[model samples]
Target chain A: AQRVTQPEKLLSVFKGAPVELKCNYSYSGSPELFWYVQYSRQRLQLLLRHISRESIKGFTADLNKGETSFHLKKPFAQEEDSAMYYCALAFTGGGNKLTFGTGTQLKVEL
Target chain B: SAVISQKPSRDICQRGTSLTIQCQVDSQVTMMFWYRQQPGQSLTLIATANQGSEATYESGFVIDKFPISRPNLTFSTLTVSNMSPEDSSIYLCSVEDQTGGDEQFFGPGTRLTVL
Candidate 1:
């Protein structure tokens, strides 16, 4: 069974501080990881994928096969960055199915 | 990116009743999925809505309890039958990006509260 774990239920940081949302996965095969964000009153949207290796909104995540972790990171947190972040994993031959982790509520204080 | 919409954005229903949530996508998509988000929990995939065929349900999800229909590529519906208070959750529909990048675009979910 493929499982994604996000340890933090809530992460609070002041503006301009660095932010890191931890995520780990348990999958046997090669896994593709992604980060999704949902702002207040907005629908869920894709933030970035590991395969792309591109940063979105100053957020970046690297897939660590050795540690089985794909943590989201941002250098300077902005007040507008407050939202719910979800880490998801998909494996080969899974038919595009995604296993999501319990989201982390990021509250960036002014 | 696809524009997705869900009907009956929020509904309060009595126990034993059923509520059908409709999902519509602006463009045709090959794979559509239904998900449930319980209060304070992560989103769980319910099933994959296959066009012109029966939906493929995930483990622990049964067709009898959550019936899904995908008559076409752009539309799908999920019905929660014999609802209970435990069924209170936000049901969302999403479409896989046609470019095949494994990214999914989600619709504004339908919030159901059963009392």
Candidate 2:
């Protein structure tokens, strides 16, 4: 069975500071990792994907196959970046369901 | 990428009553999925809605309790029967489009509160 693990529940940082939300997964197949973000009172949206290798809102995640990790990082955080971030893994199991990790709530203070 | 929409953005219902949530996709999709999410928690896959066929539900979920229908590639619905307080959660519908990748686009979601 495939599973996603997000070690942090809450991460607090100041505006313009660097932020990293840790994520790890357990899967034997080639994993397709993604990051989704949900702002207050808004719908959830895709932030980025490992396959795209592009950054959104200055956030990027690198899939480290050997480490079994895909950590989301932003060099300079903004107040608008405060939101709930989810790490999801899509694999060929359970009818290709996207297994999501318990999200990490980020609070960017000024 | 695909765009998805869900109706009844939120509702408060009494116990034993049922609510049906609707999902619509902008373009034809290959697979539609339903998921449950508690506040401040992760998403749990409820079922896979296949066009012209009965939905395939995951463990801990059944058709009798959560009936699903996918009449076409662009639309699906989920009905939650005999609701209880435990059923109060956000239900989301997603799609796997022919965008040349396995990325899934999600709807805004329907928030149900059973009392």
Candidate 3:
């Protein structure tokens, strides 16, 4: 079965601190990974994807095929960065449905 | 990224009633999806609302219970029929916008509460 897992349900850190949200997956074939974020009272939005190899709001994720992981990391957390973050995986064979992890609530305090 | 909108941002409904959620996109998208986000759970794809074709439901979802309609390239609707308390959750519509690898854009979501 293909599944995405976010080990931590909640993560808290002070502003300017380094932050890391771990995400792992179990799949049989090549998987495309992405990170989605939902701010308070806001819609779920795509933050970054492994394929893009680009950083957004100082966040970056790397696809580790051997480890089956795509962890999101930020060098300096901001108070405005507090939100719910989800890890998603797209199976190439299906109708392009996205499988999502349970999600992690990040709270960056001042 | 494409802008998406959903109607009835939040509603409280009685059990055994039904509610229809609407989704509209700013541009014509190739893929439209309906999702359920129950309290304390991740978003689950209920069905794929393909324009001009019957929806493709997920394993645990059915067309009879959750009827979907896609009338055009940029609009779709999902109706939750015979609702119960279990049906109370946040419903979201999404579209995949990508050149190769898929990245999804989502609506603000409709929050349904059953009593």
Could you tell me which residue pairs clash in candidate 3?
none
Clashing residue pairs for model 1: none
lDDT of 1 by residue, B1-115 (tens): 7899999999999999999999999998998999999999999999999999889988899999999999998999999999999999999999998585757999999999999
Give the number of the best model, judged by DockQ.
1
2 or 3: which has the higher DockQ? 3
Instruction: Give the distance in Å from residue A28's predicted Cα in candidate 1 to where it truly belongs.
Output: 1.1
In model 2 chain B, the worst 10-residue window by lDDT is B96-105
**Per-residue lDDT tens digits of candidate 3, residues A24-48?**
9998878888899999988898898
Residue B3 error for model 3, in Å?
1.4
What fraction of native interface contacts does model 2 preserve? 0.68
For model 1, the DockQ equals 0.84
Query: What RMSD does each model have against the real structure?
Result: 1.0, 1.5, 1.4
Candidate 3 lDDT over B2-115, as tens digits, reads 999999898999999999999999988889999999999999989999889999998899999999999998999999999999999999999877653566889999999999
Which predicted model would earn the best TM-score?
Answer: 1
Q: What is the DockQ of each candidate?
A: 0.84, 0.68, 0.77
DockQ, candidate no. 2: 0.68
lDDT of 2 by residue, B56-105 (tens): 98889999999999999899999999999999999999887657476678
How much lDDT does candidate 2 score?
0.92
Lowest summed lDDT window (length 10), candidate 1 chain B: B94-103
The Cα error of candidate 3 at residue A75, in Å, is: 1.5
For the record, the alpha-carbon RMSD of candidate 1 to the native fold, in angstroms, is 1.0
